[model samples]
Structure formats: structure tokens, C-alpha cells
Target: MKKKYLIIGAGPTGLGAAHRLRELGADDLLVLERHGHAGGLSASFKDDKGFTWDIGGHVVFSHYEYFDALLDSLLGDERLEHQRESWVRSCSTWLPYPFQNNIRHLPPQARWECVEGLLPGNRPEAAPADFGQWIEGVFGTGIAKYFMNPYNFKVWATPLELMQFGWIGERVSVVDLRRVLRNIILERDDVSWGPNNTFKFPLHGGTGEIFRRLAARLDGFIEYGQEVAAIDASARTVTTKAGLTVEYETLLNTAPLDILASRWLADRDQTMVEAADRLTHNSVYVAGVGLDIQREAERNPRCWMYFPEQDSPFYRVTNFHNYSPNNVARPGRQLAFMCETSYSAHKPEKLDELMDQTIAGLVNTSLLDAARAADVLTRWETAVDYGYPVPCLERDGALKAIQPRLEALGIFSRGRFGGWKYEVGNMDHSVMQGVEWADRMISGTPETTYRWE
Candidate 1:
């Protein structure tokens, strides 16, 4: 006689939802994931050399105290806390991250060139109609020309002007003129200017370990690697890719609503299916490249590097090994690096070409020395996809209409692609969004993660 809940996707979001249900003393709740293992985009892998690598670039940073408490309880004192040492590789110089914060590294000639772009007339300040306008508005012509424009093109595979800026919260730093001038004059680093000045990682496993640990406490309550194919919401029954049908009293869907609506409600309700069609998604590729370098970043650990140059196929490169000693192969062996790129569905790319381009970028950016290319043991992984919500002008209007309709039907769709609000769509926001939704369901409280802020 207990109320039943059917949860989909065993990623962090789904795991959070399931954990909350157990805490609320709820029975008849089930969690299902399509991957053979959990973790979704945040999974990890080990190689023959006992080295670990994450699916994409993932870091643990939380804004809420409750989310922090949940992770502390789960991760315990063994968490590998990392001081975020991130930087931007602009042209031949390794500028301190948040490029605008530090410009002293550039030579006088380069400084003048950067200054040239900073003139008042060049500062784009017309309220930012798109992502391009947003970048120019925020950093001004100086940093945008040097980094934002070209780097964003490779990263998102779209014009910055065509994209929307609502999603760029802690992702990029907004410029400050007087502060930038002071930093360059003082010749100091301003890496801590962003929201995530410090982050945490698991001691043993990669980011994936957090979700795995959470699942362990939940008992054998998860159905792994099983995809949700269809749902008869009217009958309160759900069907899986393997043809298992289960009934539920209410449904918590964290999968892409388009997939949910198309496969489940397409035949049943034509409107739900059509509303989903308005959503847009961009594909993400994380390339794990193992290089044989004479001086491995191992000698000096740096958290990550950002690419704003066209030379690199990826817009971001996280020193996967630097996150933790466990992330790399045996130190005596060779070192490795990983890069990430987000692509549009309308613009697909071939892996071979991308790898070749990436290698070329390493040479141009001086990250990879061709002289030492012989010693480098290289491997490429395009294993994961799905990143960066493509925010066309119509995105906001479409989501506004679609979300309220679903909430009215006793369904809560939330997550990276679930609610599709990029402003607060990082790992911290995504997991907390799920937990808040679970709280709402348990106590009849309000949920902001689902509601557009």
C-alpha cells in the first residue's frame, strides 16, 4: 500500500533522488540506468598501467551547504582536495587563468596589441543578444579577441554571437578594468577570481566514485545498464529497453525530455511529444591522450589549462594525471593529457580528423613537443557525448511552455538536460537539483531547481 516511484538514469542526479527517497522512508522506489555501470558523463576508467581517467573534465564544487554535507558524509575525510590551478594557453604565452585578471605575462608588443582591443569604442556593451555578445560584453575586445572568440568556436562548434550567455555563471570571469591594471602592474596571479577557487576529488576512484559510493549505501536497489524505452503515464507503468514493465505511483524523469517524450508519450499524447521537439542539445567529446614527455606535468602538477587558440581542436585541456596521482600511469613510465570539445548535432565531426588536429594543436601551443613525440605513448578516447545546451533565441520561450505543462502532470524533469537551464547546470547544481526535487516530493515543498529562476 506504499506509494511507488520510478526513477530513471543512475547518474548522479538519479542516485541523489533515490537516496532522498530512502531517507524519507519511502518504499517501492526503483532506480534504473542505461550504462553497464553508473556515473553517466562522470565515469572513470583504468588502463593496463593502472592509471585512471575520467570520461570528461569533472570537478567537485558545491554552492549549497546541504549538498556539501551530503558529499562530506559520502566522501568522508578521505577526499582529495585540489587547489584549482587552472590557466589559459593564449598564443605562445601561458596567461594566468581568467585572462583579463592578469596581463603582465605578455611582452610589451603583445600588451599594446591587447590594449588596442580594449579601446572604448571596441568594448561591446549593447546588452548581449547572444553568447558572442555576452563574451564581448563581459571581457571586452581585449580578452575576447585574444581568447574567447576563436577558442569558443572550437569548443562549442558554434559562433559565440549565435549562442546565449545566460549559462556562463562561474564558467568565465567578467572583466574589471582597474583590478586588471593593478594585477599586471603588481605582476601577481589572479587564478582564484572564479567561483571554484578550490575543489575536491575522491581519494581512490575518480569522480565516478562519489556516485558509486552513494549507490552502495542504497543497497542493491538499482537496475544498471537498462534503458527506459517507454512509459504509460496514464496507467502508471514504465517499460525498459530489455522489455521489463514496472508500475509506479509517480515518475521522476531525469533523462533528456525529448527522448522521454518521444519514446514514451509520443503515441499517447501528441502534445508532450511535440513540446519536446523544441529542445536543443550539443554533443561533447572528451579526448584522453597519453603523451611521453621528457618533463611530465608530474614534475609540476597543474589542475587544468584552457585553450582560446584555434591551434587546439579542444577548448579545454585538463591535466587528467594532475588531479590525483591515481589518475596517471606509473610515474617511471610516461605521462598523459586529455582534452574536451562540444559539437552541435547539425555539425558532426570525424574522430580521425579531430585527433590529427588535436596533435597539431599540441605542437602549435607547445603543450606537446614534436621532438619528444617519439617517446609519447598515445591513446584517444571519444567515448562520451552530450554537453553544452545550445541556446538559440527560442530556447527560453520553448522551455517556459514545456516545463509547466509537465509539472502539472505530476512529473518532475530535472538535470543537465532535464530542465535545460544552463545557468546552474554543473555537477553540483545537477545533483542538488535532484535532491531538492526529492525533498519537494517527500514534504510537499517548493523546488527552485525545476522552477526557472
Candidate 2:
């Protein structure tokens, strides 16, 4: 082997970098994956019935043309595109997705109150410093209290007030008061406003399969099940969990930077380990339910919905079977996918109790019916300890405090957790990070998405 570029964690990021290197006719690339597969937490599995589901919901919505082109080249025509009809289920009603901005669905009393808060005459003459303040700036206090604030705390596992509003980009909705009021008076849903209105999903395998296929294509370059245990920056060498060492000119790590930092610290002493402890990530428990519903995937083409009310342990539910017919067993087949949830530490719910409660909540919410149901087929979990990178008030301070010093030591950390910018850290962003890293390393191209883009 040519002792080439060492790519850690064969997730989307690593695989993307390797594939890009090969596509560019570059050589001496080695990808080390911790798990036995290409996809990390974004991996997928099949039930005995051959139904495919991602570790969690991994929808494909990219900002880069390269990402879309890469995916199309992989899956080709066997892809499914869906228009998301998402809404917030609260106050015993289904408010449209831009819930705060679309308060026309709310009852008369609530609507008038929201209007007074947001209506042009009473606009606040200030800028928002926190997520809560941003909500008030965008939707006003009345609407913020009703959905934006609590729903955010439930989803992000951090209080809105504790988070800086800088990360909020196209991820949120800022309503035009006049347009909102006009649409509301006309009894319009206006749900088709966001960037995810039309999104693409894999037709056969789960979202993870895209990376799996990418790995298979780059067979000679990637080594699965090879976990990176340590990195010696002085000599530019990487040691695997299994004691195998490889020397590289430059390394791109897709593993959590904190984890990689810990391993690098372990190669030294306790002082570095103490500093590494400041990095925080939320653990997520995803419960995948396989149910026996009568409706075919076509009838319920609706992808997923959010339930922020007190009745459900799951903050969000993906109609997995509906997302892709291949996600569940066919009509005569045995296993049919039901729902999937992302449970974080903020609203920690017991797995057993929460699952049962979730099923009951499904019945109550007219999702899973009591009368027509098959025995609960499968209930397995995919727990990710480093799911969400908490955007705490101190996150920027902590990163600036630690990351630059690490970077100074010849460590180029970049990935979902590596860069710690959730706004762009989806599969696409992760891949782009790797691409940019490799490009910068090889050709000295501008790596915009690494820190800023």
C-alpha cells in the first residue's frame, strides 16, 4: 500500500472523501471505518422480511449541486421524491408547519392574540440575542410561548434562551405578518413554503444504502471494521482499535472530534483528557415500530409528522412505511414499518414505558388503530450517544477555546460532530466537509464549508 491519505470513520464523510479522491484519479487512499459497515449511525438494516429502514430518519435535502449529482449517479432512477406536508400537532389541532407564522389555524381567541403580538402596529424594536428572543422577533411572544419555545426545548435538548440564534438559518420560518394574515383569512394552509417542500428519498434501500453503495464502489480504497484507536500527530500515524498502524501525510477524521481528541490525548497524558471533557453531545434513542396497517403505502404517502404534545414519548414520528414502499414489507409480506422516534436526553423517556405509551398514543391520535392491528412485530432501538451537538450558550466559546489549539497541532477535524454545525451537518454537509477537506489537502482549493460555508 502507498501509505496514503488516512480517512477515519467510513461514514458519509469519509466515504465521500475517498470516492472523490478516486473520481479525481488520485491514489494511495485508505478509509478506516469503526463499524463493519460503511454508514455509521446513518447506516441501515433489513428485517427478516427484507424491509429496509435507516438507523433514524435520513432525508436527502442538499444545498450543493455536487451532493445531488453524487446521489443521482449512485441510485439513478430508483429514487423517490416527496413533497413534505408537515405540521405541528398541538392544542388538539394540526397547525401548519410554519406553525408560528400560520396561526390562522388557531381558534379565534388564540388567533387574535397572535395577531396583536405580531401584527405590524406592535413590532418589537430590538434584536434577538437568544433562540427565545429570536422566536419573539419572528413570531412574537404569544406564538413563541404556544409552540416555538417548548417545541425547541423538546427537540434540541436545550432551552431556547440558552442557545445563540446564530445557527438558525433556513431551518426556521420567519413569517411576513401581512402575508400570514391574508392567507389565514382566506383559510389557506400555506404549508408548502419551506425548503423541504420537495425532498428526495431512496426508493429501495434506506438512506444509509447510498453510502453503502458508495463504499462498495470504492472497495479497494475503504477498509470496514477497522476502528481508529489513536493518532500521533508528531509522526503522522494512525493506530486502529485492533493495533494496526498506518502512516499518512495528512489525516481527515469523521469521528467525533472529541473522541478523536481523547484518543490523541491518551497518546500523551491526563491534561489533554481534562480539556476534552468540555465537549457535549446528546444521546438519542430511536424506537422503530413495525405495525400491520391495512392502508397501502400509496394511500398514506404522507412521510412523517411531529407530535410535541405531552401524550407522546416520541417528539417526532416518521411514517417509515410510507416514506418508501421498500421500507416495509409488501401487502402479502409479513413485516410492515410503522413509526420511528428520536428521543434525546432533554426529555428522557424509559424505553419500555415510552414504547408502550407511544403505541397507546398512536391509537389515541388515530395513527395506529385499536380495532385493526397486527401484533407488534418488531421494536428495536438505534441509540446514538453523540446524536446532536448541543448548541449551548457556551458552544462558540468552548470551540474557539479548544479547536484552534488542536488545529495548530496538525489536526484537521471536520464532520457532523467534528465541525459541530448542525445546520449543514446532514449527510450532504458531512460529505461536502470531507470533499472540501480532501480538496484542500490535495489541490489547496478553498475549503469554504469547513469552517464558514
Best by lDDT: 1
Clashing pairs in 1: 34-225, 131-163, 132-160, 132-161, 292-376
Clashing pairs in 2: none
Could you give candidate 1's per-residue lDDT for residues 1-453 as a string of tens digits?
Answer: 123887888877888888888888875788878878877767787765566778778899888897899999988986788888878887578887877777777767766666666666777667878888777766766677787787777776766666777767667777777777778788777777766778988877888888878888776778876788777666777788887787777778878867776666534366656656766777777776775446544344678888876666788888777676667666545566787876775556776677767767767877777776555565666635567666656567667666666666666688877777776677888887878888888898787765653
The window of 10 residues in a row where model 2 has the poorest summed lDDT is: 331-340
What is the per-residue lDDT of model 2 for residues 1-453, given as tens digits with 9 covering 90 to 100? 336687887888888888888777777879888778888877888766456667766788888999999999999998888888676777767776878657788878778777888866565658877878778877877777677776776677666787888877887877787887887888877787777788888887788878888889888777767777677877778888777888887677778867776765435444445545666666666767675555553244456766766666556777777667778766344334344444554556565575677677776666666764447777655667777776666666666655666666666777888777677677888899888877877788988776732
Point to the candidate with the largest TM-score.
1
lDDT of 1 at 388: 62
Q: What is the lDDT of every predicted structure here?
A: 0.73, 0.72
Please identify model 1 stretches exceeding 4 Å from their true place: 1-3, 107-110, 267-275, 291-298, 331-334, 345-347, 378-380
The global Cα lDDT (0 to 1) of model 1 is 0.73
